[model samples]
Target: MNKPLSILAVYIITAVSADESEPNIEEICRFVAPGTTILRPNTCEQWVRCPTAFGAADYDDGSCVYGLYFNKDTGRCESIENVNCPYESNIVKNRCASKKTGSFLPHPTNCKSYIYCQNGKEINATCPNNLIYHPTKVACVYAKQYECELKTFPANANPICKAIPKNKILADTKDCTKYYKCNKDQQLVKLECAEGQSFDYVSSKCVTQKSAICHPLAPELEPESDVCGNADNVHIGYIADEKSCSHYYICNKRANGRPDRKPLHLKCQNEHFFDINTWSCRDRLRVQCYLDRCEGIENGYVNVAGDCTAYAHCKNGVTIKRGKCGEGFNFDERLQICSQQNISYVACKS
Candidate 1:
């Protein structure tokens, strides 16, 4: 330029120059201020401050990184430090795996441990601070996170639930008359009727189809002339008059042999006798049957051959022959006459 600018006054742009020479002071002053953020254009490398001066821009290997810069002196990476970093750069480690990132499984593996590396070798590489690796979910989570595992569930996962059809089996359990059991197809079927009873589905109450008969309760039998008396002391009986059409019976044991027996004798007529014993008379006609013969009435008879005879008076002084006045003269009370004699006189000769 004019008189060739002096070396000290020469304006040099080191960002564009290929030579490694002294950097311009104005360029260093322009980059070192606070809130400066930039990277090298060619390499895209990033650093927190200016390479020539401290507190210039945020950068890492030509790519700009985000961090707060601390001092404005000593223009190098050692001189410029991050004010907001929690730990050293080589301590945090991240893990990624196929099982974690696959679309079928939505879980992911995050930063899992603090791994310190020096000279390309691991130092104190430990698992994450308060977490462990879950093999099922393939993710790092806090320790003892889950109480139960999926495999230990009560039901299997394959079969989907469905609404079952309504049927008789469910209803049979409520009011089943017959004993029922489930078939292979899960249907209720009748086995048999219960003991001592047969099933009647229509009635739904157990029934005895045929029942046994008990003996005729307290039967009483007596002779033809006598009334009903206690046969084997169970049923009582009595004697009835021959002329009476009604018969009598006594059922009260206390009044059976008692002298005050009028209260116990329930005298019932022939019409009532049929009703009490549930029987009917077969011999409809017999003149002697009108009288209920007691002992000898079956053989008892009265013979009337002719009209009334006379009463012959027997005196103590008179010699009465066979209770007649004379052999052929018979005295009659009804006619009071001694008719003309026709003598068949054997008893009169005495």
Candidate 2:
């Protein structure tokens, strides 16, 4: 008797497990509306409105025929011929009309191309020339990789090209008092100097602008008449030489008596003139100078050898040495001396 009871218990457990795995069709169909039909048997989740003649009985037997779509308004299945639809009704067609016509969208695979959806399909388009399409901006713009040619500008002016010039000054557009310089490869780079420091155009460097004797655009020349000694007596430290505009001098307040004191006279070497920015003498090409004497040479001196092969270096208004051109060259005053080898030193008339 105990063995029979154990067998009965095993049978009951097996039946319960089988029922759990199978879905309940009757319960699923009870929730379905009267005019709707189940999409499939056993799995009674999907339901769609059926033709007026089809009912629950036909739906359970799977005898109801479904059309392309169901009309919720009419409570009936619809054939493709009976259905009327707009082009934008589909997802692809809608996106094509709205996104493609309204704005540009970048392609998922290519940086230079853009994608547009049309007629339930995706269309790819490319930007013009070397330009790239920017999705966020929705427009074709210049590519960052391309390098443009450099442009020229007048003195103390802004640049047109994106490329920055190496050591140049430009007044700040926002603030006239501030200035900027170009860094390597980066154009219109803002130069931030330390406190009390300012950009010097002559030197192409940064210097302390406060308490400086000479301003960038207009510099004051040192006065020769001050007799009082000490730093206070000196208004300007350097000034262009009165005798020769090509030379400059520094104020010396500690010399001689008051009112007749003289400043230390100085001259630029090798025909260079005073550069207000550098506060030193530089080549003629780097700085502009106007005088009757030859440029890049000391004042009141000439290339004694008329072939322009050599010249005399002068100091303190006197010739110190006979300067010679490099080997295999003759200095011609007309050719600006030592710049070219048009004439041989031996054959040159001196």
The prediction achieving the highest lDDT against the true structure is: 2
RMSD of 2: 35.4
For candidate 2, write residues 7-114 as lDDT tens digits: 322322232221222223332222222333333222211233333231234432332133233222233444322322111122122223323343444553356777
Q: What is the lDDT of residue 73 in candidate 1?
A: 22
**Tens digits of per-residue lDDT for model 1 on 1-350?**
11322331222211112222322332322312222322221121123332332323343333323222221122222211122111122123221211122212211212343323344333333345766445456555676773322211111111000001112111112222232333333333445444323333223234432231111111221112123332333344343333432443443444345322222344343222212333232221111222221211222211111211222232332212223244455433223344344422211121
Tell me the spans in candidate 1 whose CA falls farther than 4 Å from its real position: 1-36, 41-109, 118-120, 123-350
Compared with the true structure, all predictions reach lDDT values of 0.27, 0.41
Listing every candidate in turn, what is its Cα RMSD in Å to the true structure after a full C-alpha superposition?
48.8, 35.4
TM-score, predicted candidate 2 vs. hidden true structure: 0.18
